[model samples]
Target: MTTPLTPHITTPITADLLRGALDLEQTAHGVLPHRLPARARAQCADGQLAMAESQPSGVRLVFRTRATAVELETLPTKRVYVGAPPRPDGVYDLLVDGRPAGSATVTGGSTLTVDMTTGTAEHRPGPPGTLRFTGLSAGVKDIEIWLPHNETTELVALRTDAPVGPVPDRGRKVWLHHGSSISQGSDAASPTTTWPALAASLAGVELINLGLGGGALLDPFTARALRDTPADLISLKIGINLVNTDLMRLRAFTPAVHGFLDTLREGHPTTPILVVSPILCPIHEDTPGPSAPDFSDLSDPGDPSDLSAGRLRFRAAGDPAERATGKLTLNVIRDELARLVEQRSADDPNLRHLDGRELYGEADFAELPLPDRLHPDAAAHRRIGERFAALAFTAGGAFAPEAA
Candidate 1:
C-alpha cells in the first residue's frame, strides 16, 4: 500500500483487484474496465456498443482487508437524457464477507448528455468523486464494491483504514452471458440486483456480464470477443436487440447466429453454451419491432418533468405484414433459435436451447408486468434470477457440476 493518503492507506487499483471485466486500460486518471477487449473494440465503431461495454455491468472491485471503513475514488460518467425525467444516481453496492452490506454513489465526476430522440450524445468531463463506506465489524473480511451497472466508471483508488490485498480465487466456474438492455439492467434497482448478477449469486459462480444495452446485434467483433473470453458456461440471450434494431432479416439472421456459435465453439469445443431466445415481450411477440418511445401515454406532454407520473413506455412500430418479408419478431426468432439449437446439438452435445419465456412468460408478466413494456422491473429481475438458478444450476442442468 502507498503512504497514507491522509487518514487511510491508498491501495493502488490493479487488474488483479477487478472481477468480471475482460480488459483494463490504464488511463491518465485511473484504470478503465472494459467488457470487450481492445482488439474487439477496434473492430467495431458502433457508439451504443462502445458506451454499453464501458459501463461495467457485472464488474466489481474485490479484495481482502481488515478495515472498518473504506472509500473508493472514481471518475464515473453519468448519462442524462434531455427532456426526460431525471435518472437516479448510479448505485455502488457493497458486499462484505459475501453478504450485502451497504451502498454508495459518487456525487460528481463526468456527465454524458444524450438526445434520445436524435440518438446522439455529448460528453463533458469533470473531476473525480469519492464513494465512502464507513462502520464495519472488526477483523479481516472479503470486500466487494459492485460498480454501477448503468454508469461508465473509471477506478481511481481504494482507500481503507487498513491494508488491502487481492483475494485468492475461490475456484468457482465463470459464467459469461451476453444480451440486450434487459440483461444490461435497464431498470434494475442496483448493480448486484440485476438478473444475471442475482443468478450468478444463487448459482455460486463468478459472472462476466456483457449484457450491453442496444448492443447485442450479431456483430463479428462481438462474436470474436465472446470467443476469446474464458468461461466454463456461456449463454447468448438472442433476438431482442436484433428485433429492436431491425438490422437483419431471415436470410442474414440464420447464418449470423450460426457463425456466432461457431466462433465460440472454436474457443471451447465442449463448453456448455446455452442459446436463450427473447423473453416474453408482448408488444414484439408477434408484431415486429423497431420499437419507439411512446410518449403518447403522458398526461401532460408540455410538462415533460412529469415523466415520472407515467413511466416511459415503448411500442412496436413494425407492421405485422413485414413478417412475411423475412422481418424478425420475438416469436419468429424463438422458433428459429430453437430449431437451430436442436440441429446443432446433434453434433455439439454441450449446446442447448432455452425458451426465454420459461424464465419470464405469460404468468410472470401478469404477476410482474415490465414497468416500461420493455425491461423487467426489480421484482421481475429477482424472479428471473431465482428461476434461472433452479433451472440451470440444478441437477442435470446445463451448468450443473455433474452435467458439465
Candidate 2:
C-alpha cells in the first residue's frame, strides 16, 4: 500500500510510546528493547535467555492516530535452523481501536542460523525493512503495532500521514505474565495470538509478557525482574522449563520456589499472584524430562508404506525411575506446586494456584494434540486463552473487576 510521502510526518520511536517492554537502550541503528532490565540481563550467562529476552514477546508501539497510512522501519532478527525446513516469516499485527486491522511482514532482515549438531550460530546482517500499513480506519483511535513475538526487532523510525501522539491512560489494570516457550507463542500464528495476549484482550487489560522461550528456569534475576516491575496482576507458569532442562532436583526446587515467591512478595506484598503448573504434556506427565528433539517421524501415520513426510518432534529423555531419587516430572511438579500454594495461601490470602491442565487437558489433547509433542498449536492456543480468561479474569477470578 503506497501512501504519499509528501507532507508526511516522522515520529521518533521512544520508550513512552511503547508498552510491554521493561527497558529500552539506544543502539547505533535504532533503539533495542529489553524485556529484562540491564541489571537482570547482566546476571545471565546463558545465551538462550539473552535471545529470549530480546525477542519482545508482548511488546508493541501504541499511540493515538487518525492517520490512514503508517510505516515503521525495523531491523528484525530472524532465526534459521540448519538441516531443517525454513521457518515462516515473522508477522507484525496492527490493531485500530482495539481490533485487528491488518498484518505485515518484511522480506529482508538480519538472519541468525543455528547448527543444532554443533550448537553453533552464524549471524548474517541485513538492512532494515519497512512494515507499512495503509487504509486504516478514519477518526482518532488507539493504534497498536504488535511486534513479532519470536523475532528480535530494533525500531528505526515511525512515519505516518497524520500526526500521532501517546495514547491517553485508559485506566485498565496491567497484567504481568512470565512463563516458557509455549507462553512465548512458539506456534501461535502471530504475536497478538499468543495465549497471554489473547486473554488480556478478552479481559480488557494491558499486558507485559515475560514469556522467555527456553529461559524460564526460575532464575533469581527473573524473580527480581518481576519484583521491580509495576503490575496490577501477576502470574507465573512454572514446571515445563525446569522439567525439560532437568535443572534441579526436588529438594532444591522446593526452596527455589519459596525463595522466588518471597522475592516477589517483597515488592508486591498484597498483589494478586497466581502460580500455574504445567499443562497436560503426555510425554512429560510421568517421565522425568531432560527433553530431546526427535526428528524421526512427527507425521506418525500408521500406514505401512507412506513415510515421506516427517517433521521435528520432541520426547522425554530422562529415566522415569529417576523420580524416586528426587527428579522432577510434570505430574509431580503439579502436585508439589498445588501443595505449596495451599500451605502458603493460609498466610497469603491473595495468592492463588491454577492447575494448568484446566487450561488444556486430556480431552482437549485428544482433540487437538500438540503437533511438536511439546508446544500447543495455534488452535490449542486459542482454547487455552479462552479457558484462561474464563478461569482467571471472570466473575470468581483473581483479576476480575469485582475482585479488585
Candidate 3:
C-alpha cells in the first residue's frame, strides 16, 4: 500500500518547464498501428516506487511536483487518432501534482481525444491511455500518479512545462533486468502484467527495465547501457531470442555475452547481477532460429529464406543436440551464461545466474501457448512472478525486509 500524501501545487505551467518533446520526434507513416515514435517511451515504468520486501504494509508514495503547462500533441495533423491498445475498462484517477485533475476511461484501440482548441481530453469509451496535465509549475516538487488496481497503464505521450524531480519513493535495493521481447512484455496481456512487471510487483523493489522488443540483439549499445546503469539486483534472460532470431554466429555469440557482462561490471562494482537463460519455446528449443524472418507469426509464416543476411535458419526437424552442435540454442546459452558467471565468480561473488526454464518449461507451455509462441500469457506471467518473488526476495536477498 502507498502512503497517502499531498504535494505543493502553486506553480504555473511555463515554456521552460515542459519536458517531453520540443519538436515532433517522428512521423507515424508506414509504422504499425500500435507502434509509437522512437522518442516516445513506454509510460508503464516511469515514476516507479518499490518497497523493501517484508516492510510493513501501507507504504506511502508521494510525487511532489508542479506543472507549468501540458501539451497533448497529436500526429497526422488534422483529426488524428493515437491508438492505445490492450487497455482494460476502468475509470482512472488522474492526479495533477497531488490532486484529482480529471478522469479518462480507456477503450482498447479507441482514440482518446486531444482537442487542439482546449487542452481538455476525454476517453474513447474503454480504459484510459495517457492523462496529460498542463499549466504545471516549473518547480513542481512531487507529481504523484496512482493506479487503483494492479492493472497495466500505458502512457502515450506527455509534454509538461515542469521539471519533474526524482521519484520520492525510497528503497535500499534496485533490480535491473535485461532481455528480449518476453521481458519487454510482447504479446503479454498488458504492460504491468508482463512477467517482469509481475516479478517486480511481488518482490517490492525498484526496477530499471532494459527489455527491448525485437531489439535485444546482444548489441554493444545495450551492454553499455546495462554496464553503466546502477543497480543492487540484476538479471539477464538470454537464449530464446538468440535461437528465434538467429542474430549471431556461435563465434560471435559467446564473446558478445562476455563483453556485455564485463562492461556492466565496470559501473556496478559489487552489485548482485543475475543472468537467466531463455525459457523453453519448443519452436526453437532444438533448432537454431536459422536466421529467418520471424516464423512465430502464425498469420504469415514469413519466408525462411529471407530472414536477412548472415542469419541462421531452424531445421524443421531440428533436435536439441543438433541445435547445440551448431548455433546458439537455449541449452547452449544456458551453459554459456553459467560459465560466464562461474568465471566471473572467481573474482566477483555478486554476480548470479538462473536458468529461465526453471520459471517456465515445456509443461507450462502445454497449458499456456505463448500468444506468439515466444511470449508468455497472463497465467504464465503470474507463475513467473511468484517464482521470482520466492527466489529473489526471500530472506538475505537484496529486497528482503529488515529483521523485526
Residue 61 displacement (Å), model 2: 0.4
TM for every model, in the order presented, reads 0.95, 0.95, 0.60
Off by over 4 Å in 1: 1-7, 297-310
Ranking by lDDT: 2, 1, 3
The C-alpha stretches of model 2 lying farther than 4 A from their native spots are: 1-7, 296-310
**CA RMSD, predictions in order:** 2.9, 2.6, 12.0
**Ten-residue region with minimum lDDT total, candidate 2:** 302-311
lDDT per residue, candidate 2, 49-93, as tens digits? 888999989999999988888999999899988766678888999
Model 3 Cα lDDT, one tens digit per residue, 287-349: 666433233433333543222221213332334565535666766777777888789788877
lDDT (Cα, 0-100) at 152 in candidate 1: 92
Q: Could you tell me the TM-score of candidate 1?
A: 0.95
Q: lDDT score, residue 204, model 3?
A: 65
Native-to-model Cα distance after best TM-score fit, residue 143 in candidate 2, in Å: 0.9
Q: Could you tell me the TM-score of candidate 2?
A: 0.95
